[model samples]
Target: MDTLALKILFMVGFIAAWAIRTPYQKRDKQTKRLAARLVLRERVLFVLIYVGMVILPLIYVFSPWLSPADYHSSLWAGYLGAIFFAISLWLLWRSHHDLGRNWSPTLEIREGHTFVSSGIYQKIRHPMYAAFWLWCVAQALLLPNWVAGLAGMISFGIMYVLRISNEEQMMLQHFGEEYKAYMQRTKRLIPYLF
Candidate 1:
């Protein structure tokens, strides 16, 4: 497939992902938070993620600025990317659905938050993160531009490395032994594997 077609395909998937998250994002705003840790460092990381996952990808799709970094990928790779993108969307939706009002954009424990160990969470402690990893994979395969394509992984990887320990610690503090046992049994992302 041509680059233009591939870009268009990516936009469709992106828009669908956005639509899936819209309701959940809005719902999260109304739910009262019991605690939150939106520190400056966390805010900066989020900004980086926004630039990488949203701004850079948009620039690559809509402008010629990233054309110089474009590379050819096999047709099969593009098809595989579409598949990965679809799976990411599914996992994203499922993660939000299973978490319900327990979900928050930042490190937060909502009022009445319960330890969720069902649905996708039954096997993976962070299915949402796994979905995002798949998203980055899809982005890399679909964009065909070195800087734009890899930006999501580079940015999110940094944030994941810096934030996951803190996130798990917060969970341990809140849920105590329950979360610790969950962690012992479940992988962070993959099912029975990491």
Candidate 2:
């Protein structure tokens, strides 16, 4: 398929995946306080970063931001990045699967929610963030142009800061000491060594 068609197909799949995988709902969240709780910057970053991650790789297959040149990768870098990318994506899918009815695109906790400390959660508190960072670093190695790759890296970095801050605050507010204990036990992005 062509670039535009591929982009459309990927985007459709992305949205559909989220729609199907996300088990949370917006029952009475039309309130102003609840609305205000969702940080606009974080929300925008989530959208932009996610779209950029998907679209950037698609561009590699579609558009030519820059032609492939004499870009070389160390064997170690390729092996490590590919391994991390695959593992990270699997962790993400697992985290989302385990989250089930508790998953939200933004940082809103459902009423009477329980903290998740199972599956990928036991290994890392934020597998989703880990996946994102893995994706950025992986793309930097996988893609040819420094410009395209750097865009993903920079955007993910900014988004990571915002996402961690906002998500942590929400976690604290919703999960309280239970989450604090989890935080003490697990690192944020990295697993055992952060």
Candidate 3:
């Protein structure tokens, strides 16, 4: 298959994976108290990520403005991108499964939220973030357009750097020593090394 096909497949698969969790998240949201919400900085990052990963990529795929010049990469790169995308999707699914009702689109403590340290969560505190990184890498590999391909990394990388400490602080405040112990045990986005 060609680069455009690979890009479309990756993006579609990414959307489908996230869409699968929408209902569950909505159901959880009904009961969630929203102890905290994203501040202006985080909200900015959220918009950036959404636009970079979804809007820009779609434009690049379907329109000529974004993808001005066609760059060539080997078929092996496409296969590698597909593999990364697949892994990302799996990580997303598993992270959602582990977090369940505790999951929120933004930074917020859910009502009756429990500190999860099982399954994939046992190894990494933020598997979802890792999945996102994978998605970014996949996008870079699958899409040849510089604007679309690198946007995910640039947008999401900013968010990750700004938000991770705040997220950990929020969790630490909510869970206290329990979360501290969990943090001591597991890495943030990688296992054994961070």
- Candidate number achieving the greatest lDDT relative to the actual structure: 1
Off by over 4 Å in 3: none
Q: Candidate 2: worst 10 consecutive residues by lDDT?
A: 27-36
Q: TM-score of every model?
A: 0.97, 0.73, 0.93
- lDDT values of the candidates? 0.92, 0.63, 0.85
Q: How well is each residue in 41-151 modelled by candidate 1, as lDDT tens digits?
A: 889999999999999999999999999999998898789889999999999999999998888889988988899999999999999999999999999999999999999
Q: Candidates ranked by lDDT, best first?
A: 1, 3, 2
Q: What is the alpha-carbon RMSD of candidate 3 to the true structure?
A: 1.6
Clashing pairs in 1: none
TM-score of model 1 (CA atoms): 0.97
lDDT of 3 at 121: 96
lDDT of 3 by residue, 36-99 (tens): 7566776788899999888888888777887565577788878888888889989998999888
Q: What value of lDDT does candidate 3 attain over all alpha carbons?
A: 0.85
- In candidate 3, residue 151 scores what lDDT? 88
The count of backbone overlaps in candidate 1 is 0
Q: Per-residue error at 147 for model 2, in Å? A: 2.1
**Clash statistics: count for each candidate:** 0, 0, 0
